[model samples]
Target: MAKAIMVQGTMSNAGKSLIVAGLCRIFKQDGYRVAPFKAQNMALNSFITKEGLEMGRAQVVQAEAAGIEPSVLMNPVLLKPTNDTRSQVIINGEVSGNMSAKEYYLKKRDIVPEIQKAYQKLDSLYDIIVIEGAGSPAEINLKENDIVNMHMAKLAKAPVLLAGDIDRGGVFASLAGTMMLFDDSERAMVKGILINKFRGDKTILQPGLDMLEELIHVPAIGVIPYLSVDIDDEDSLTERFEKKGAVGMIDIAVIRLPRISNFTDFNVLEYMPGVTLRYVKTVEELRQPDLIILPGTKNTMEDLLWIRQNGLEASILKHAALGTPIFGVCGGYQMLGTELSDPYGVEAGGTISGMGLLPAKTIFEKEKTRTRVKGRFHSQITGLLSELSGIELEGYEIHMGQTRPIDHQIACLAVLDEISGQQSEEYAGMCDHHIYGSYIHGIFDGEGAAQALVSALLKAKGLDCEEISSVNMRDYKEQQYDLLAKGIRENIDMDQVYQILEKGV
Candidate 1:
């Protein structure tokens, strides 16, 4: 059995994910076999494990901070919203079915056994389990059937660290109101209250912190300063899309679709020196850039239609014709093809014309392709991108469409499955002149691939192509984890945290 502590937030995007990740890293640094657990997660951002099982990406990031392999058991239930009302429910790494809000709420209790089993599995393998809660524990209407907040804490026999987002305003009201809403037993589970995203002097906050602790009968553990760490985010609340930097030496524009998923694919590109990456939602925002990117989306057909209706499709076509390099990944890859056929009614039933950037036709299937892959760019690439040839890359594929390119278009990558050791000759991605399309989600993650593309872009623009130092994505992430742990250690009282875990509920 493993000792546990849960992190519950006052609301969504209250920094629960990062805090839990920081704690995981701290525990790992302290020489404990630590693991992260989130019984239920609602996010479009997801990852495919080595076993071809699907899980939330936030847990994957936490697992990385813990210096462990990501597992589906870390996130047992994942809800990916397809639209405003319905979400595709995944239990234990496999898709169960789509369910409406009411349907899921009524049936959520039935999945408790699965959650317990997954938690027990991690508990058995690790010394400590750091659990993360979804949204708030104060949603009175939804609290009865909740398996992710106080209910989950009781089940895990874990003391809770309730966090309030001071940055969002009314931190005192939110924390006090949340505690007021809880029953006596539920309130008893909360051992500490953490004020997150604070940006001010500690002396001024000390008065409020003392008042809050006295009001709630719980200790104020810490007030974490606003951290600006480069890491993967959970959902649409991510601030990456809002960032619009001035055009630097190298500018890259990514089309922001309505249902964008895995936009973190471009995170590494933003870290490169002399490079500016921006997500453009409107056609007017898509100014003349060195490179244009069409990112992944959840609803391929609907978002493609949105692009066409909003005039972005025409603008992208004009840019592509004028020799501006264009690249697409996953759903964006499907949109770049000559046509998209949803015969199985996966997204929207019927065949629709594509952007015609690539000589490929995509057909949506019921069964999704989810796997981790590693490969290198094909030797025979065309035009300015010939420099990208032989650049090795590794990423994962999570899509419902299969694209088949015409004879003239050349295959870009020759991939191999990481789990099955299956070698696939020219299994993924295609290129035509300056336009490129691929199903690989993390195509730009590798140092070789990103550098090659940047160099090629500079060469096309008739600029000096300097040999930049390669950045290993794995090493960069490890450095980020260490930074996160350091921040947590400096701000929070680790002795009290350890004591809470020692004397579990």
Candidate 2:
């Protein structure tokens, strides 16, 4: 079994994921075979592994930092919210079924064995496992059935580092209150405390930190500075949605669906210079931009209905009429078609009228399409997007249905296939004039595709389209990981962390 340490937060969005990712990178740099583990994750941001298995994106990012291939064992149970009350439960990377909150809570105990099995599998393969806990461990009402906090700590025999968000204010009370909720044995499992997202001088915070440590009887090992790193976040509490910046020359707006999933697909475009990518939720927030995007959603039919009910559909259609570039991915792709049929009650057992932006129709199927694909843009393109022709792209598909074009005039955007050399002439997406729709997520992660698209947008705006150097997404991510590791190493006490891991509770 591997030596392990777990990061539990006093509340959600307390920087547990980032801390664990930083630790993974630091351990990997020190020549240790480290991996990330989360017993259960309730999030909409997910990824499809090379093996076509589903896992949380946070674990995938942590795995990248560790310089290891992501495995389903790293995230055993994934809960993707379908609505306010129900979620689609995935165990061991496969769909178990959809369950309501009450039903899932009652049955959660039965999944413990499965979680333990996955944990042991990773433990046998790696030298260290940095575990991440979901939400807070101090939810006293839910702690009895908890498999992700103190209970998980006891199961893995892993020491815990409780982190509190200082930026949210009352960091001392948050940490102390969390400690008071836990029993003596449970409190003993927490080896140290960390203050995350600190912005001001540490010298001024020393008094509060000292009082917090004395009250909780746990040493405050670190005060991590608030970092501005571009990494995939776990859930709706992500800061990316609220962050607004000056609109660059090339402005891109993404429709923020209520059930948005795989929103990280646009992160690369956000990193590009001279581009301002913003997420718009309401029709009023929609602005005239060079390009507009519809991101993936957990429930396509429902979210599409939301667009219609909220008048966003009218706003999008109006933009499309003005020849604004419109693109969609996954569920968004389904919503852009002419019609959508949900036969299996996947999202409601009825047909819905799509935005009719593209000449296509979608049918919901039981099995999900999950695979990695490599390909090049179609030889032909429409309107201002002709520059995208011949650009190579690599991405993954994770969707619930198949979309097909209704007419031969609608051109396919790309010719894609499995990375294993299997050829697929299947029309992956449809493009008609300035309107495009595709089921492929992360298509813009590659430099060729992203750069070409940006150049076309620049040309459409009648701006000088200078040839910019292409940036490799993978290399950029590695640099960010290094930055995160450096931040953690300078602030956190690594010696104390190692000591806690060595001498477990």
Instruction: State each model's CA lDDT, in order.
Output: 0.89, 0.89
Model 1 CA deviation exceeding 4 Å by range = 408-420
Off by over 4 Å in 2: 419-423
Using Cα atoms with residue i matched to residue i, what is each candidate's TM-score against the true structure? 0.98, 0.98
lDDT string for model 1 (344-437, tens) is: 8778789999999888999998888888888877777776677878777788889888999876546664444342246665467888888888
**Cα lDDT, model 2, residue 18:** 98
Model 1 has an lDDT value of 0.89
lDDT of 2 by residue, 120-215 (tens): 999899999999998989998999999999999999999999999999998888889999999999888988999999998899999988888788
Judged by whole-model lDDT over C-alpha atoms, candidate 2 comes out at 0.89
C-alpha positional error of residue 73 in candidate 2 after TM-score superposition, expressed in Å:
0.3
